[model samples]
Target: MTFSPDLTETLLRPLLRTDPHRPRLTWYGGEPAGRTELSTASLANWAAKTAGLLTDELGVAPGAGVRVLGLRSWQVLPAALGSWWAGLALDLSAAGAGFADAVFAAPDADPEVVAALVDESDPDTVLALSTHPLALPAGDLPPGARDYSIAVRAHADRFPGVPVEPTATVLQADGPLGGDAATVADVIERARALAAGWGAQPRVLAELGVTVRTTAELVAAAVAALAVDGSLVVVDPASGHAAGTVGADEQITVSHPF
Candidate 1:
């Protein structure tokens, strides 16, 4: 149940291959009422295409820094993979907390950037990343980024994995911590044990940022769920923090919440 740095590829990949979509991704977003879904297969293709544009066209190095600009979602997964597939580091910057790259903004984004994969949202919320530019809903877009389709479609449909260097950084959330500190590897390992007790290879995973939750709780739980070929069901913000847990069988652990 212990997770290593290489677990994402070594042990986790095979576990994640629940369907033929292991190499692909899926995303579900919304609150209160559920929204729609995005398939991994679709994401895989998009990631490949994006990787191509970012590397071949834009000339971003395999180990260069590439930042993701949003919270968890189907699109964000592909964007992350596309960066990894292109051999770039993922700088995960919280939307409000500014990073140098995040400060670059959509308007200032250029070929140096691989691409900004914004959520396909209402004309206002993420209209910048949507295919449409005309009619608008009710919201404001953090200017500069383009529609995800424009970025995704600009490249080829296939990309290879990019290697990483020790000094390179890919921001990720760790488990709980003291004050501003985050959890260590040992704690994440213990949580894996707790998950195994409830059920190994969990199917559904739910993570909320409302409080002091650990990233290990989030990623490890998702990885474990995927390990058992289970669907990693993301809990929406509006959905509150409720999830269902079923007896272990085909589904394994029904739900994991952080």
Candidate 2:
């Protein structure tokens, strides 16, 4: 498969055309009930809805910043991809998240933390995910926040917009290692490099909290899998399952601490 340098072109379009029904992401939360699988077509649909939410409802323009707060979960997939679809820079670090144009938080996050975020960053929009296994609407949220599960349902499955420019910054992070940023082109290149050694159709296993600190790392892992016409299996340490166990169960071809 020819790899496109563009983030969306590389990650979504090609896979949708070639293998839309193939499972691209399978997340295990330690139990059968916690498992959530998304095929390329389904993932793209959610991403499109998320992009519509940001662009049409929130009025977030291309090149804006979107703060994403959450552990590694199935929810992060759409949030990351959707942000990219909308041409927004994804800020995975909490250091200056409040200053972003919008914020997306996990459903089970502490209310105090959410309140503090609202107070500190005072962003124009705050979206809280339900994180429901079935993608149901969340019950309640912090003041001034909207339920992403409900809001996103109203958006179309296909995003009605042009793809983002390759030079646009897609990810930003402030980690213990240091502050980092990458453009769309940079992300594609990094993903290609990461997958270069992995054989064809590599099924990559990556754990959140264990190996991934920023959403950018997860994105890279997913893109790498996509580039090879492969798949990504994500395990959250919080799920209480060992990475090796999940990797074995998924028959992963490669494991990377992205």
Best by lDDT: 2
- Tell me the whole-model lDDT of each prediction, alpha carbons only: 0.41, 0.74
Q: What is the C-alpha RMSD of each candidate to the true structure, in Å?
A: 8.6, 3.9
Which segments of candidate 1 are over 4 A away from where they belong?
A: 1-18, 21-35, 38-40, 93-140, 165-200, 207-224, 227-229, 237-254
lDDT of model 2, residue 177? 19
Clash count in backbone of candidate 1: 15
Cand. 1 TM to true fold: 0.56
Per TM-score, the best of the predicted structures is: 2
List the candidate 2 regions with Cα displacement exceeding 4 Å.
1-6, 30-33, 107-113, 120-124, 174-179
- Number of backbone collisions per candidate: 15, 0
Candidate 2 lowest-lDDT run of ten:
1-10
lDDT of 1 by residue, 48-153 (tens): 7767766776666655555544343334445545655665544443332222221112221232332333322222212123211221221333543445545456
